[model samples]
Target chain A: MGIQLDFPAVLERWPSFLGGAALTLELAALATMFGALLGTLAAVGRGTHNALIAGACKVYVETIRNTPLLVQIFLVYFGLASLGLKFSAFTVAVAALTINVGAYTAEIMRAGFEAIPRGQIEAAEGLALSRVQIYWHIILLPAVERVYPALTSQFVLLMLASSVCSQISAEELTAIANYIQSDTYRAFETYIIVAVLYVILSLVMRAGFWGLGLVLFPRRRRLGTPL
Target chain B: MQQNTSSEPIVSLRDVQKSFGPLKVLDGVSFAVDRGEVLAIIGRSGSGKSTALRCIDRFEKVDGGEIMVCGHRVDRPDVDLRALRQDVGIVFQSYNLFPHLTIEQNITLAPCAVKKMATGQAKELARKVLAQVGLEEKLHAYPEQLSGGQQQRAAIARSLAMQPKVMLFDEVTSALDPELTGEVLKVIEQLAADGMTMVMVTHEMGFAKSIADRIVFMHRGKVHESGPASILTSPTTPELRQFVGTGNLKS
Candidate 1:
């Protein structure tokens, strides 16, 4: 039998799809902010001279990057519950996504940090800048500027990967699609609509990051120069 | 020259030694810089001239002996390094200005963050130093926006913003064009005339002959000759004569 087209049937569930799309975005924003903080800290930790701290951060980044995101979500959702720590599906989704993306962010940030020259740090030292001052002014801010594009792209991927959270019935767009398709008995139509929504969501995220890039790195925007 | 209460030597390295892995860069190097005096260190590449300056700022840890900067011993394991660095400023050949910051921000960062000065106060001080470097008009310019000379002057301004007791210049003008070199060298000469203590590692024979109070030549990580600039013009040592005779001394 030829595939029957029923986009209109799935179109009737637009409100549910819209709501699911909004929640996906909310989950992405929350994960991006928190994950960025966690990742930056991990990057600094990995670059430190202390072997123990560096080793631990290295292990965390490698372990997360090596494992599949599906297994990670399951582990985070069921593992936490098994430990008697109950969290809502949305909360678990955000938590799992944050943990997963934080590792990639760490590696990207570490590359940014390494790109800073040894001479710059020595110059900061010669100026009598304290360790904190040197790290913030010479290292951290410029590193962010150098790697902002990479960082933002990773966040967009994180938004797409958030679809995996549907496995736990997180009530995001994919989960909503599963619900609507079963109710309307139109799996192909529901999935196609949901897939289009994801593409729109990713585009929106890309635009948002581009705007943020303009704001955060005004030097680059105004002068057309890299920091 | 007579010494005043506040005019003690700003930098004194006694029996300093440094080694990287198995190779020794500086072996038992000792030198001193009197307050308000301009000292020039001349040496072939990798002869420890730059390494000696780095030791004064504790950028390179000394394996043995003591480095006293503004009366504080930096070689001690328990010293407050950050505080020590606040009194000694250094300029590099690459002009290592923070490329992300504007000239004004680059100059004011250490003062506001490390010295804990108020932001307004730091800005005022930065403006004054930028004016001193003739870069007051370029305060908002980034490093790449400026010419090589302007960037070096801005680097000098950044160090001067700290109001350091001593300044170390590691071939500050080497990276600039000949015409551009004059602008930076003029600023250094003005600082010397104003009685700022400075130790400069440079190949500029004219700068040394005209501005320096003492000239020291290093070879193979050792100070081969130490005397007045007149003596450097016609050095007693064979190594010093060869170094100054060849145009290699003029970066």
Candidate 2:
């Protein structure tokens, strides 16, 4: 017996797939921004002289990183409902994804922070810059620029992982793909198209990040240092 | 504490002591720099010259001694570091300019942030200092884009912009090549001729001989010998004679 391929049947459901892709992008965008802020703060917190804050950040990163993402999604979906805290599936998806990706971001950013040479901070101190100023201009921004590639990669993975939100009825790209395949009984074609859509989205996001990086770190661009 | 009188030394370290783990880096080290006086500290590697310089800026805490800089008690734990640093500017061997910022920003950052100087004032100050270092045209250039010589000059300009009472240079030209070192030395020489109160730790026997009002030789964490620049030509200590004896050096 021979198997035949049919992409048209899945392509016919373009509008539904487009809506799902848009929703997926929306979820990823929200999670990405919040995750970055939370992650950067967590990274700084982990490096503090305060024992309590550092320990707390350590525990947060460790617990979230070791556990599965699906469980985290389910916990936000059902556990919140059980506590009478009902939010739309979209909101729940965004929250869960932010919490999940934030841990990874913290680790990446911490490595970036640690990589900053001691001379940089010492130079800032010698200049008499305030503690806050040293952290912002000397430590955080340069560290972020140094680790920009790792950060962008983590964010792209976050966009792909938005697919898991489908399990919680978040109605993102993967959820829409499931509905289309079931309706037309064309599972293989549906997934193939979804995979291709994901690749395009990743490329688009990477391009956008590259442009932003150039604008954000003109020094790197002028020096011809690749992001 | 009483205010510092004009006749008083600008910086004084009285029997300052410092240790690193099991190693004692500074032992009963004592020295002082006066207004418009240039002091050069020369010693072999691991002689604690840099450590003693760092202590003047409170970069390293003295184990047991009194350090007075511009009337601030540096040995006290509660000393206002910002105020102390505002009066003392330090330049390091590695330039240490903020790579992410332009030269203009690097020079103006401390003044604008600490003194709350107006933007126009800081810009004028940056321009003036860059002019002083003969780097007036490289205002917008990043540190990495400049040559090592240019970068070192820019670092000196950055310290000058603070309008400090005293400047500390810790082997400022140690990391530069001969050509670059000459360029940076010229700037320092001009500063000394301008009568800026400064203490420098350096290994350039020639530069120290010509520019220093006094040269101090440190050996084994102690002041082995110290006096006028003429002392290099006629040493009173074997340690210093051996140090300057290595070559027929001249600036």
Q: Which candidate is the best by TM-score?
A: 1
lDDT of each: 0.89, 0.91
lDDT score, candidate 1, position A21: 96
TM-scores for all candidates: the values are 0.96, 0.95
Which whole-number lDDT from 0 to 100 does residue B119 have in model 1? 91
The DockQ scores of all candidates, in the order shown, are 0.80, 0.58
On the 0 to 100 scale, the lDDT of residue A73 in model 2 is: 96
For model 2, which pairs clash?
Answer: none
Number of the top lDDT candidate = 2
Could you tell me the TM-score of chain A in candidate 2? Answer: 0.95
What are the fnat scores of the candidates, in the order listed?
0.89, 0.56
Docking class of 2: medium
Candidate 1 at A226: error in angstroms? 3.1
Q: Candidate 2 on A86-162: residue-level lDDT in tens? A: 89999999999999889999999999899888877887888888888898878777888989999999999999999
